[model samples]
Target chain A: MPLKSVYKLYQDMETEQSIISYKGVVSADLLTSVLNIMEDKLAIIEESVSIRKKVYNVLVECLQNLYHHNEGKGTFTKNAKQSISSDKASILIISKPADFYEIKTGNFIENQKVEKLKSKINHINNLDKEGLRDLYVSILNDGEYSNKGTAGLGLIDIARKSNKKIEYEFKPINDQYSFYCLNVKIN
Target chain B: MENINLEGTAKTPSVSFEYDNGTIELRGRSIPENSVEFYRPLNEWLKEYSTCPQPKTIFEVKLEYFNTSSSKCLLDLFKLLESIPKDKTSVYIHWYFEKDDGDIEEAGEDYQAIVPLPFKMIEVDEI
Candidate 1:
């Protein structure tokens, strides 16, 4: 496997029409900074309130999931060949295409948890709009719903806001963990 | 019990509770690192407020954004306020959002559907 050069990653992002691309440790402080920058960028772009709200809302959920699920295991670096090690690693990109803005996130998860994560994504993808809403409400009201420091409403909320199927792919990085990528389209 | 009034930050919303006037307001962005921790005190305050419930209480929430964790915490706050007897206290939730933001309006509706309160969706020109 060839290593991804930092410059090539920039060029690819340029071709993909992405703005505000970050790949590294995702701390709470980073979330705030990224949100401020995203808000400024969104304001300059002059999108409708509904679209802006959707993007912002989805971004929040994505950042939360990234922060919560990041096990500090997978190397959180733009280029794995680099020796930089930042704990709590993840990737976030906001791209604007012709029709809609796409928010893509990449992170690492333990191999043991891959099956559960895949099943959750599959369940969310299979749900209709109404099903998503019901799930969101159900989890919200259930006081006992607790796992890995989340109410499990992040995915449901993301699916609900996107109004589309949540796209996700998993790749085996090693025998221990895999790289999980999620794609959310906001039109 | 003293009312809880704290300023907002870039990640957390500002909290204001006026026991005298019966007004509880949370405005600004809400995506705190630990929402349960951030909202625990407010929930405790509401529990104490129910002891000497206000006659007419108004809960105003004007948030620009909130993550899933904060969403659950907000629901907890609302549920606490909802526990106050309706006969003793008339509660109204003023959920404000940008006029063009259907997402915020619907978020408010989600809360309205779950909680038994008179939810007023206020449309504002700006967030």
Candidate 2:
């Protein structure tokens, strides 16, 4: 962490035309603040009410997914005697690079959970608008809630609203954990 | 049965279920961190209301936006409303959406498809 890097970070955000960027622990209170801020920002940037509503709806799903999945704190053994701590903090960035708004989120997840999540997103990505709507309704009727009260419909809802394939990646962090990043574009 | 009137917040909706009149209302946003906890009491209240409901029950949902989790809870509420015997009580649901909000309109349609309750979609200038 150097003094000059702070300026560089600011420059990068400006270059991306970022509306808002946040990192660290994601909690319910923080989610409220983020939503309020985004509502105000989108109100100014987007003139059409429908597009604003769509972007706001998609943003809610994305932030909630990040909050539910963030690990917060974890430790990994580096060697026989040394250990490294991983802050499993989550990240959210809303930027407008072109005509569309780009929402990017990142969080830590269990390594074993990577394949299942990847496959789910892939399945959602492969569906057309009508197929996605059917899947969403079926899941809404039959899907069981997880311990965290999520019904596994977040990604599907995001796909349906954005009308675009979800872009994601899972970067292995250690034997037990991986960093998951999701990027969604709303036009 | 006792009535329910909860104030709306930034994350949760305002609810008013009058047991005597059978007028149920849910308005505003519903994206609580724990949607289950927030909607559990309402679900229970609906279950109780079903046992001896009024002649005609009117349930109005005028939500600006709701997350996926809240959507599931809302469906649960609708199912309970659907369970009430039609011979005993007839339930009417009015799903409200703001102008140009297709997502909310579509959501109402989705619920109408699953639950056999009489649903009316109403569009307005604002919510």
Candidate 3:
């Protein structure tokens, strides 16, 4: 791959209105730093306390989901070739493109898991605001935790809090893996 | 039973459970990476406290923010509180949210609906 010029990278960020963008392994320490940076940034750009809280809440769910779901170093597809970079490395970009702010995250997942995740998000997207709230409460009351200590409420909570449809796409990395990309909009 | 007084951190909340006074308090952000692990001690403490709880138990939660995992763990915590026999200890919950923080306020209302405990919603300048 040719190395992109620094100027071009800067221009890309500017064009996208990206305030913070990172592509690497997601870690606990990194989650803290990212949240802190966004907190400072949101404090300045957003004035309403309710909206700020909504954005911050959605951010916590998105970053924590990435931290938990990241598949550690493995084979990933880049340019249709088997490339072994930190396959666990994910991408996060926070931008304000228009009236709303967008949080975009991409991570690698086993191809087998794609169908279930797709169904889950589609189910959430179909729900109205009231349905989303009921689902969140029901899951919370169910009191089940995955091995990673998640309650499976992240996406629902994100949707309920943001009041927006979550945008997503899955690109096949290989037969073994696919990249799961999620975009959440907060106004 | 003894008291649990834990300091708050960037990812977890500060917990104070006074066995004698029956004041159970949790204050701070609760975005722990492993919320189940972080809350295990409190769950155990509540289990023990339930055996001979104080006459009037007051549970207080003043969280600035929490992730979805923490939210479930909190429900688990409340379930434990609900299990305490009312005859032994009259339980009351004080749920605090910062003014204008509609998300937190609504979260408190949601818990109040499902937890089966008398909850007093308190709006404060900050928590």
Candidate 4:
């Protein structure tokens, strides 16, 4: 990571009206505390019941997705070599941009998975409301669980609740790994 | 039949299935890390309840927050209720949400549409 790019990232976050941002290992216990803290923060800022719920719901999905698939931390993809140097780590930023709250999450992933993930996200972004809802129903009933016993519903749930398209970028860190970043918005 | 009462924690819901009252209420937030493990016992209890369900079993769900994993467990619970012969056990799921919380109402509708039963949406001041 270059100094200029890091500085640019900092400036971007600074202007996005960030409520909170965190980096490092994402554990189950950490998720519990983060959710509690953010719940209180959301209650104080938003008076509309629906917006608060939408933001909160989307936040949970984002955090859970990080906890489930972040490179070496989660018990997904048994064949991939264990990554070193903050590969288990993920970043979370809750920001208020314009009329919507953006939950931005970044985590390291095996480079080979970039195309698969990009396709999945782009497929979700292209869906109409009805398509998303129908997809949610089928995914829920599909009974497919990851090795960690997660139902793989985190991303779909985020897309269903989020009224806006999910934005993302896959920045290659090395030949072996890349940083998968996603920005989901709620109105 | 015996009652199934479990206290809520920071990451789990409070469950109270009183056999005497024929009422089952699930309240509070449910965001357990391993939701499948946390909800397995409840599903087993529901299995037992199915064998000897009351004439009229009423489920009152007043959850403020729950994860997608817990969401699946809830659907499983509703599906179990749908299995019991209506003539033997008339099950009614009352989904309570705080007023102005359209998201919860939408969640309830999602469950209502899937489960064939008299699932009512009730608004409250708070849970």
Preferred candidate (lDDT higher): 2 or 3: 2
TM-score of chain A of each: 0.86, 0.93, 0.93, 0.84
Question: How much DockQ does model 2 earn?
Answer: 0.88
Docking tier of model 4: it is medium
Clashing pairs in 2: none
The interface root-mean-square deviation of each model, in the order shown, is 1.3, 0.7, 0.8, 1.5
Candidate 2 lDDT tens digits, A99-171: 9999999888888889999999999999998899899999999999999999889999999999999999998
lDDT of 1 by residue, A15-85 (tens): 88887889898888898899899889889894586788788889988998898888645344445575434
Query: Per-residue CA lDDT of candidate 3, range B11-76, in tens?
Result: 899999999899999999999889989999999999999999989999999999999988988898
Error of 3 at B8 (Å): 1.1
* Candidate 4 collision pairs: none
Local error of candidate 1 at B39, Å?
Answer: 0.7
The positional error of residue A12 in candidate 2, measured at the CA in angstroms, is 1.0
Q: After superposition on all CA atoms, what RMSD does each candidate show versus the true structure?
A: 3.2, 2.0, 1.6, 4.3
lDDT of 4 by residue, A147-182 (tens): 775777777778888867889999987676788999
- Cα displacement (angstroms), candidate 1, residue A61, comes to 0.9
Q: DockQ scores for all the models shown? A: 0.73, 0.88, 0.89, 0.67
Q: How high is the lDDT of residue B109 in model 2?
A: 94
Candidate 2 vs candidate 4: which has greater TM-score?
2
Model 4 clash count equals 0
